[model samples]
Target: MKFALSLLVGAAAAQCGKRSPSYLTWTADSFIEHGVEKNFHYTQATLYLGYEAAYELTGDEKYAEWYRNQIDDAVVLEDGTIKDWDYEFYSLDDYRIGNNFLWWYERTGEEKYRKAADIIREQINRHPRNQAGGFWHRRPVYPNQMWLDGIFMADTFYAKWTKMFDNDNTTAWDDILKQFVLIDSHTRNHTTGLLAHGYDESKTAVWADPVTVNRDSGSAPLVWDRAVGWYFIALLEAIQLFPESHEGHSILVGFYKDLAAALKKAQHKSGGWWLIMSEPYPGMEGNYIESSASAMFTYGWLKGIKLGLISKGEYYKAAKKGYKLLTNRFVRADDECLLNWEGTVEVGSLCCNGTYEYYISIPLQTNDYKGVGPFMLASYEWETY
Candidate 1:
């Protein structure tokens, strides 16, 4: 379960330049060689997504095989239950890796993958929800709250699970859309169109404002870029599985388009987003361009355009600009030609009033899977579409 904290030396192409498929291959190979860990967590789960995208784009069995090996070795147990996950903790973050379970199930039609995935589905059915029916991000910790990031973690898998195993369950589709609708109504700023990172529905969190803060109602104080990025990617992923004729599809599309326009406008001159996405605090020294959110937006814009949810010209320009900056600014090639992704904010949360200082103070990391995974996805989307 150990990861090489330092960059690994390896032979590969030595460029982190524009729009080449080799970059994607190099990135994936570097990660696989780094050794996928056995621990079940969002960072690794996020990277699994990049691997999934790589497999899809290149048809390389290595990418798929790497993922399959990790799941078999690290995730599922002898009795078809999952390991390294606690049933007592109803955290949405834990639900993410289940997407890999679903993917493996579809690939092999194996009962073990299905059994593992059902464990997550069972948790989702029983997970506590706020009065409005939106999930609490985590029980006991962050109670009575929902975060923009939570939707991506839980509902994307929920939508895919329903589609795969319970397509006839009409209520599940309605519930999926309700999460989006509630988060939008509660957190979105009508003027800026960006969502706050999290919302405390009971208005009990220290960060939840009693009144509008920067025009966003009662949600966590600021628009942390990666938080919004999570919601953005989730929308694209979930909508594809959503039945188009369902009434909720248009609702989700409307939410997606609004955020898309907001993100397009928020793009920094450098083709990235600030760590703090709300109005820049005057004299804040630590605010800088973040890598993961930039990569996520790049992936979202490109994927959205490919899905016909957004138009090509404007978003394509934004995606291309972001991808180029993503490569030149954050992604690097070491002496061994192994790709390194840098400048990802370690974490941002609703603690400490979700303050400007708090968001800026989080440490930056290199090869953090959160950033690495999205960078891989962005690179794949850039090359393929």
Candidate 2:
């Protein structure tokens, strides 16, 4: 088994060289030259995470240097304090970039990175939670709501901080586990074996069904693709960080397996996932395969299989098929050798009682950070497979 795994890794490494460094460098430079205003957002932070992973996969110092410069531009200040980070809003999205801070701290042993990470941790310490102990996606306005995106934004960082700084504190693990359990219990649609985009604990969101006794009651109207993608990746990342001996490790692994099984069943005939994943069939108006979510799910599958959390064969087949689809359908190269990713939804969110039309009508953009970030991550994972 060990020999077989090493062969797979070796083959994957050889394949890694075929990926375009010029494309990655162009992408990073584009974001950097635009100045920090465009670069400091959480969306850009996600792309940086992919660049960091690419650095490790390809042994390229430029990718690593790009990751460092991006984070430093966002956080490092003259007084050694991390700037432009808002702890008062209590939004989980704000903490997503802290993953880069933690990564850079470990890479360079820099105190500034640690200090920047502390700022995010301080926000999590005070973030509001619903009655069931799930952290609210945001505060004040979006009270009592748990968006699937929040799990990836917050829990992974929390888990890593506990592992690195609070090794003796088991309570953090319990808290992290509770977020997953509550979200799963509330958002799951048993009929589809998939999770909804968001849950309203107050059952007051216009998009939520206040009267239904079905499994999706009090949840958003649709099973959004990218929301679940964020969650799927979060589970895999948390498992990677959690100590195997910890009680929660097996539980996280189980959750990942369940999600993987459901996602496998939902993959489109074209080897991608739809904008609304549950709407996989043709002639479903406004239902088209989306790039970002497909890439994210692919990344999760490849990483899960690589980590031994998922069985091989079927999952690997799905990942390879999806990766090919991404390359064939969404990826295009410019004359300058820069890659452009297409078919990504510019943005989607639940606002009051949003309809299926609302989701389908959202603009499709090329090379959006959301799509490009996951594409890069998926590419790195595929090459390392």
Candidate 3:
């Protein structure tokens, strides 16, 4: 039955002028064939998210089966506790893979997965927050800071958990909405209508403005494309799980629309976005099209359209173009048939000054999990859309 559905979807995709070779499957297969890291990192969770999407799109059990085994092996222990789970560090990035825990619980009625999820939820409940009530991106190391990346890492899982376990808790719903509102208030770029990479609420970080926490004062010198990409997807994820009757539903939807419009305007002519996404500055000469963020934005736009948050007439062409450019420019095949994604900044963080040079100077990597995960996700969204 799954085979028949695949064939039918394949034919429809071909009729729609989709790439005949199934980039989605090839990419997933390549990642699997090459082996993946066994860690509780957000990058691995992102690829898992992409696999879940592929399973949904193609009705392929292999995707789900592989994901379940990976989670069992790398994350959950036989005792139902997270393997090597650290309660002291309290990193939001670590909470992301817990989404898979909820996935397994929903499908198999397993206490082990739900037990692991409860541990993560407990950590999040106690996770440190800045003065304005944003989850500090991480504790101790990135003290009193909230990076846009943290939104996608932790909040998506929080929203899903709230929906599944505590839907009637108005406090949880309001807190979820407050996180988005707080970060947007701190980091929004008025000129570009985009948010900066992060904000330091205590104003102690080197990049933070001592007096005012706006980008102009060096709180976040420039907008990083991938950071906004994270924020964009996080908004959509929250909106999907928020009930329509919830007072925060329309507020999150409004935020999603505003960010979508801003990102649409920021799309480059090459159908990708630059490492430095904001206006041209004195040192912004060498900004080039980036892959991970492009893939993420493409996924966000396509998914937003799928959810009916935005009109297809206005955004479909942009998303379609972004997907085409992603394949053409970044997705590469080696002689071994393994896929490699190029042009992803190795790391972008508020640990530095958040300057244009800091972002552009970051090293590029091939098959970096960050790029591969999002590219896989974008391909699946494009195929299914």
Candidate 4:
């Protein structure tokens, strides 16, 4: 069945005008249009990262222009301050769009972009952390907890800031590395070699495992595909910014290799990953292949292979299968050129004991930024390959 799906995808690619279909091209426009209609937020910020990748791959000004306009709209004050941004909330999610500021600064040498990024850097400088030194996912609400999602939300941008602007500050490197190491130490399930969705240092969240606190630590119950997906992609992004001679660089590479191995094992025969990745045993209810996470893993694998962080053969094959499954099974297009990528869970969080039911209960959404962003990113990487 998987082989047949791969062949269909290959046929689709060949029949399209280019090596790949026009999904990324059309979807990029769709996402940008949606953002224009709605206010720009962190979600749109993330989608722009994928669009930025598309811009790099094709050098299309439309993609670049869309990103610039989105950033411009978000950070509108003459003084280069972000409009309507709430610094007091200290939510890691709010900081993701700062990545675009950094991107623009590097591209255009614009001081305004740098000034805008500084706002996020100041937030990170004062953001609270757990007992083990991992940043809290959010202030006041998710205290003493570190969600995998926050790693990408804050650290990727933080790492870039350190590399680009504060290279002389050696302690920034340590601060950056500590989050990954601490999170992995607390969250990883040694038996499965996969980390859980989140960890509560206080062991107080209803979702945190009481027994795990006594046995290991207070980690959440399930291995969520998108949470791990965030971690995987963040590791790759962070590694690029680390100095090769730094000990932290080796630590990150080790983590990435370990995660790549675990994900390689966890990938479904369908060439995708399950929403509850570790729960894929026969007939496990709600254990189904998810599109956004699948796209994220595909992007990570292909990018990892390209960067030589992992060996190519099996990782490349798995990536190929994932890209094929993504393009064939999930992606759809209409006559109006609207693109929809199906099977994305709109929102998943570690709330109320983190039960299996809780993981599956999140409503599925189509054309969601989480799904669309990774799909664009995966498409760009696949095209490059």
Which structure among the candidates has the greatest TM-score?
Answer: 1
- lDDT per residue for candidate 4 within 37-75, as digits (tens), equals 323366777787788887887789988887787667556
TM per candidate: 0.93, 0.89, 0.91, 0.92
C-alpha lDDT of residue 382 in model 2: 76
Tell me the deviation in Å of residue 48 in model 4: 0.4
Which residue pairs in candidate 4 collide? 207-353
Location of the lowest summed lDDT over 10 successive residues in candidate 4: 1-10
List RMSD in Å for every model shown. Answer: 4.1, 6.7, 6.2, 3.1
Residues 1-385 of candidate 1 have per-residue lDDT tens digits of: 0111222211223343323336677789988776767666888889988888889888999888778878885788767888866888899988988888888889998888899889999999999999889998998888889999899899999999999988878899999999999888888888899888888888887888856643434588688899999999999988888998898888888899999999998998878887778875422567778889999998999989998989998788888888877766776667656677778889888756788877777888888999999888888888888
* 10 residues in a row with least lDDT, candidate 1: 1-10
lDDT (tens digit, per residue) of candidate 2 on 193-217: 7888888988888887754324545
Q: Candidate 1's C-alpha lDDT? A: 0.83
Model 3 C-alpha lDDT versus the unseen true structure: 0.81
The model with the greater lDDT, 2 or 3, is 3
Clashing pairs in 1: none
Tally clashes: model 4: 1
Q: Model 3 over residues 1-385: C-alpha lDDT tens digits?
A: 1001111322333444444767788778778888887877888888887787778778899988888878885688877899888888889989988887898899899899999999999999899998778899887799888888998999989999999989999999889888888888778866668887887777778878643346443356578888888898889889989988997899889888988998899888878787887777413466777788999999889988988999999999999999987877776666565666677878888887767777777778777888887887788878877
- Stretches of candidate 3 off by over 4 Å are 1-19, 210-218, 281-283
Residue ranges of candidate 4 with Cα displaced over 4 Å: 1-22, 33-40, 280-283
At residue 132, candidate 4 shows an lDDT of 69
Write the candidate numbers in order of decreasing TM-score.
1, 4, 3, 2
Better of 3 and 4 by lDDT: 3
